[model samples]
Target: MNPRALRAAGPAILLVAATLTVFAALAYGGAADPLATGDPGPFVRWGLPVAKLVVNLSAAVMVGSLVLALFALRAGEKEFDAALDVASIGAAVFTVSAGTVGFLTFLEAFNPQLSAGPEFGAQLGSFLTSVELGRTWLITTIAAAVVTILAFAIRSWTASLFTAILAIVSVIPMATQGHSGDLASHDATVTALSLHVVGAAAWLGGLVLLVVLRPVLTDRALPAVLARYSSIALVSFVVVTLSGFARTLSSIGAWDQLGTPYGGILAIKVAALVSMGLLGAWYRQRLIGRVATAARAARSFWTLIAVELGFMGIASGAAAALARTSPPFTETPYSTTPAEILTEEPLPPELTLDRWLTSWNVDLLWAFVAGFGIFFYVAAVVRLRRRGDRWPVYRTVFWVLGMLLLVWVTSGPINAYQEYLFSVHMLGHMLLTMAIPLLLVPGAPITLALRAIAKRDDGSRGGREWIMWAVHSPFARVVTHPLVAAAIFVGSLWVFYYTDLFRWSMYDHLGHVWMVTHFLLSGFLFVMSMIGIDPVPYRMPYPGRLVTLIAAAAIHAFFGVSLMMQSGLMMAEWFGAMGRTWGPTPLEDQYIGAGIAWSIGEIPTLITAITVAIQWSRSDERQQKRADRHADRTDDAELHAYNARLARIAERDAAGR
Candidate 1:
């Protein structure tokens, strides 16, 4: 490393030292101890959290730097290359730390004696291969190792994108293996923790990347990059804040639990986060612009960055300790009821009409999505209007309505009951895949964004560039093909329900997220192919589109018929096992769901067909108007030519006779 690079590493060195000091103090400060049985030695107990801290730090470094590179840094530029190098280092540390955590976790859980023997090898092999927790860590370590090499080797945009994705995936095992997984609200807890971990890493890592790149970036480039980084940090702050609250709520049973040591540490972490947020706001509002104009402001910028790094270190150390600290609510598995045994959570109250609107079981993922969707869409429309650009009012209305419905479907009664009732699940599916898209597709969000978002001259990719890239990419072309979109829209129903995917979605939070995303995208693509005002890869002729829609509807109806005709329960272990005295029995609810799939589901299909027919009519009318205008412009020359040809044919016949 150059002298400049060594100087860049100074803040991070301070960060690590600070983090280790706080983490060690908290880990050994009566906050965490081995469970009574076979208490692992202090080394094992203390080493696990410390190892986890390294894992967190490394993950932040890997994910955050790459994210900034993708979002802010110009591809093939010196700063971008430096960011990748930073990521490579982070990935290496991530691999080592993850491996250490895996081994130490094995030791803690098994309390196995260390010896050089075949039997010991056999036990270690079983622990790594046969055990879930052990296997998770083993997988995480291997993934990190792969990323280490990939981040070091790859410099291309596409390769780096995939590498960044791999980096994110490497952390999933951490999210899944923790105490959060066994909590009462398993889905919420896992989602929250996963988001928190990723968000915090991105925020801290990007800040670190900025500090490291300070020496390489020129005065003009520095402020622009800082502006970009500020945007990322702002978003990360929101996600980390929200996900933290969700995770905390899942762990602590009541407000009174704040008095507990675990909660006290959480409070400290929250305080640190708030301090960092304030620092970020100060830099964004005050320093970022001035840094480009005044050379002296650079020092102030670095000072703020150093303080932010300190705060981030405190939060990281506290978080590592929090992982080991026992929350107020213990994660003791409950089998008091069959429902609890099956769902890993107790059943909610019986379903009612009132409860349909009132009950809320918020999925933080969808909540944030809906919130951001509304905020950005409204902001874009307002921006256009302020510039005297005409954006249809109805489009904004439809978009807002769609987002609101999304929140309601994901957070309100549908989510509350979907896992328990097949009928409700089907209803949610129809809304997500059909009704919501109908509202959202016509909004032409891509068009609005293309108009509202400013174009960038720098080689660095931003929100607008990324959105454009995705829309025009090869994958988008294939998916947005009318046949492919229709197939996914119609075929996915049978494939998801008949296959293990439905069961997976019920059993796993990640699977549920995938299911929602797949259905939403499928519906969006299909709708966009038909009535969308925005640009697309391809769309068929209006008649061909109508045929596609009708065919898809028919296939969709057959799927409903198949479901109705089923003699056995789908995922009997989940829906059938939810012990309840609800309005409908499990089998009966399945039949109701089938009816919903066929009948209520077709409402949006009918609307789509009507939309296609109307558009077809308008298209023909527009074509006719164009033809008339062309004829007017030509002054009847085509007609005169036709008459002359007839005259020549008549003259030739007369001469021959």
Candidate 2:
């Protein structure tokens, strides 16, 4: 097919592909079959999945267009404008589809009578207001509606970027709702599915944007755009693959479960994923350059994109259908323990020395974070070395070590047991806020990224451009200041604990993620302002930094002591009522946790202070060495002039007297 024709037909192709695949899969998996009881009738059984498929596809286009526009196309340019328009349209569709699905789901769940009467309206309102499922989709629809307006109105880089982020966030609620239970891996499944959904959206939508924009793109521009999109697609593929695998593993406990209908749908989705990956690789490696130089190659590439979008549609449709089909194995062991009731997972074994190193409850989200963090840093280092631009080996080592430790803190025994043990929770907190930052600050990731990322000259913002902007932005300057950073790093602990935020973090996954991110960033900023190798807008003098550290440490210790001497356990329902059969009493464990905060946490602070002192010494020595070199070069003229001026001033003073 000609490129022009292909571009115009892209949306239709994906729609048809998705429509066909979803209907087929739903039939094959018995998803559209009438429910044994509480069936909302066949129309809803079929229409709900179709609406969901639309939701997924439209969300993909919404997220993908903004992402590509932000990273690949220049603001105020035609292609950028077109991308945003596409995003707006996609968001509008997404909003409508989400609302439809939300209502249909209410009907599916309650089998309520369809009517516009007051009683029916009241029931629907209750569902939307009170039910988790109803509220989730309602939130999703509202978010998409907002994104639609933002995407249409925004033309600047920062606004577009934020809109894209908001668009991604809109899909996450949907990711959390699909077929899950009280299984231990429930959180992991939700997390993995969220990632998978976002990744696949970016991958699918970016390609669609490319086809949409090809007519508008100059030959010279297309290659660069393709290169940037390829990079995005590559990362998305990895995330989608890993998260999908984790999601699948959580769903199917037995190998033979693959023979089940749900598994069959999964196999179809997997096949589509594999096909898309292989096609992406082939074109990314061979076609992008050739397309820049040869028209024939361009044609072939366009044709391949058409095919790729079809596969993506198939994958997405399969995913939507899969959500409707019940998983093969959800026979989680029934338990009535308080811990299980509260957390939806069994209480872990007692914290022992052996389990500290041996146990792991991998948080898929942070596992990917560590994985990507290490991969990009190492890749950047390798790029520098290959080009003979130097990056310190020790920096690389520190970064790797920090990332590994992050994995341990997030996925190891600390994470596994923290929900049940206050002391273990505090241990993880200390590591996240102090020890991990200590290692990571020395790595100087910002410095490495600035040095490694290629500067784009096409008036577009790429990774390098955005990083520079963020580092130099007003927010960066303020927060990275020593005083401000110290305040946030230390003050937030008290604020978080004293407020409902602490309880929220314990109960909600989103709140937990926020807690982790807040501390990590606050700690990074504080450490960077003190001893980090990364460049910041401002830094306190060595003596001032030392003073700040001392003040911060003293306050930290006092807070810890206050906790240790508390009259009652913190988060009483959570910590005191876990019904554990091992370890110390709840109040005693709280004391241990507080002791850790006061003592063990201070160890890293001591280490940071020592590092600051060393840096100060080295700085003074370097300044002196420079002064000595200047003296040697100029025969001590500066010092002689200073002495003569002082002598003349003294003589004048004597004469006046």
Candidate 3:
């Protein structure tokens, strides 16, 4: 490996070692107590513990495999490649060892006593016998190890073939080993656990692979690669986030458990992930500039990767703990039933003050209004496309109203309360940041304003000169540039959410309004910069636009995942003050809320990304075809001119004769 690659390896190794040590400590020190025969509870002698151990160990192995895949993708530096190979092998070995140890641990946890007595031993034996063949963690681990080794050793199509085989084998054991296989028993826990494990592996594993490969990527080719991965990441992020929430809800049984210790820890995990995501967005935005300039930003890039990986590790650790922790299915002193809260008597209408319009909701209305105005503006533009009519007052009114309405709506009471309502907040965020901006860009509001002003023609040379200067000013160029708008939209999201500013913004009506306003404006700027919804001052090349969209979406996905894994409600106190009764424990509600934020918020954004991709591709194709035709015409014209010149020279010689 080169010096840079070698330096990269150091961090990777350290990260791997730290992760293994943590998991090993948990395994050795965190083992549960052994129970005697005839234990009162329905604990599955060894089945549950064994299954858990297998899953955790398997996860470690998967992580190792991902590290290898990353190295393969980033094979630019030979030394780094060699180091990654070694690390990959080591990771594989660790996975096998961990799996072996976990299996033994499971056996010991479940069947410590060999006695075939009437009470516990008999029941345990019966349960074990009832389990299907090839259901043990031992089988799954061996299969995964074998496949991983083959994938490492082979080249060409065989590697992918083996990888597929391994993935399938991994699932079989997961299906059979857990309580989920006992379908007759209707075990929700096992089913939920199985889904959760699979989804997490896909999502986290993909992220690790992407991060590792990102460093060695060529600048010219990075956008396409990133775009492909962005799509994959989006799907994985959604699946993992939704499945995680489902698993949590099923395990916890009620919203009240959110206040419990386990729920609190889970919340922390979610928040950490969200924070990491915001960082990812920053990294993405920065990387775009670096890529465009062909500058080496390896150090900064690695730093961000390290941070992202660290958070992923934390989230994984929290998941492991959650698996071990007991859910609040049983009654507790602080329990506040879901039904009661959902059906609670409404507060007396007479005592109501101002209506509670959250920032998100207000933003939603603003988005709708802005959308309507843009639609009308577009209609007017299309109608006037055939005729160069002077600009109408009504059209100008529509444009100004649309802009003002969006700004004011995002800055009002609706924006303030959005954070309290997770789904609504996310909705507001999407509209303000993604949807509304799309509308604004197509309106060509700046171009329209300039045209309206210039039409007055006061006949003063100075006034016209000033208008021209303003139109061509540096400030105008900066705001109209795709890069600048992207910076504003993405930067605002990160700044608002990551700092104390986010917390402070959640506290009051005005703060909320300001936050929403910023979100909408930033979002509008970003979309306008990337896509020419309206006539931009200057448009980015199609390729550049594609990169911007893909990179921004990836950043957004990271943010959503982070939010989903937050450990505590960042705004729990704020919600409490708002008279929002989320049962006795706010943790579960918060988790659910984050899930809403991550999953629901992503749907519209992803759709937008897809649309952008399709449109960009079409535009590029058309431009290419047009260029080819123009080139052909120019060549023909040149040939004709050359022939005519030759004829003239020949005719002059004939006249002299």
Among all candidates shown, the one with the greatest TM-score = 2
Model 3, span 1-657: residue lDDT tens: 232463466336435633553354334434233456643233442334434543553454454334333322333343234424433453465456546544444344454454556765555444444543323545555665665575465543224334544654464345333222222212233434544555555545545544545545555555544443444444445445655565455446666777776566567567755765676567566663464353466456556656666666666655554445555553232315332132121221211135443222223223334554565455555555546755555545545555765655464543443444444455656666666555455556655544433332222122233445555767768876887877775667667777877676654333554676677666666666665455457887767777877776677677767877777676555544445554324455555556655566566457556667788789789998987787697976766788999999999999999
User: lDDT of all the models against the reference?
Assistant: 0.87, 0.91, 0.52
* Clash pairs detected, candidate 2: none
Q: What ranking emerges by lDDT with the best candidate at the front?
A: 2, 1, 3
Q: Which candidate do you rate higher for lDDT, 2 or 3?
A: 2
Regions of candidate 1 where Cα sits further than 4 Å from its true position: 1-21, 24-29, 32-35, 632-657
Cα RMSD (angstroms) for every candidate in the order listed = 2.3, 1.4, 20.2
Worst lDDT run of 10 residues, candidate 1, spans 1-10
Better of 1 and 3 by lDDT: 1
Best by lDDT: 2
Q: Please, what are the lDDT tens digits per residue for candidate 2 over residues 85-125?
A: 99999999999999999999998888988788999999998
Q: TM-score of the candidate numbered 1?
A: 0.95
Error of 3 at 530 (Å): 44
Please give the distance, in angstroms, between residue 27's alpha carbon in candidate 2 and its true position after superposition. Answer: 0.8
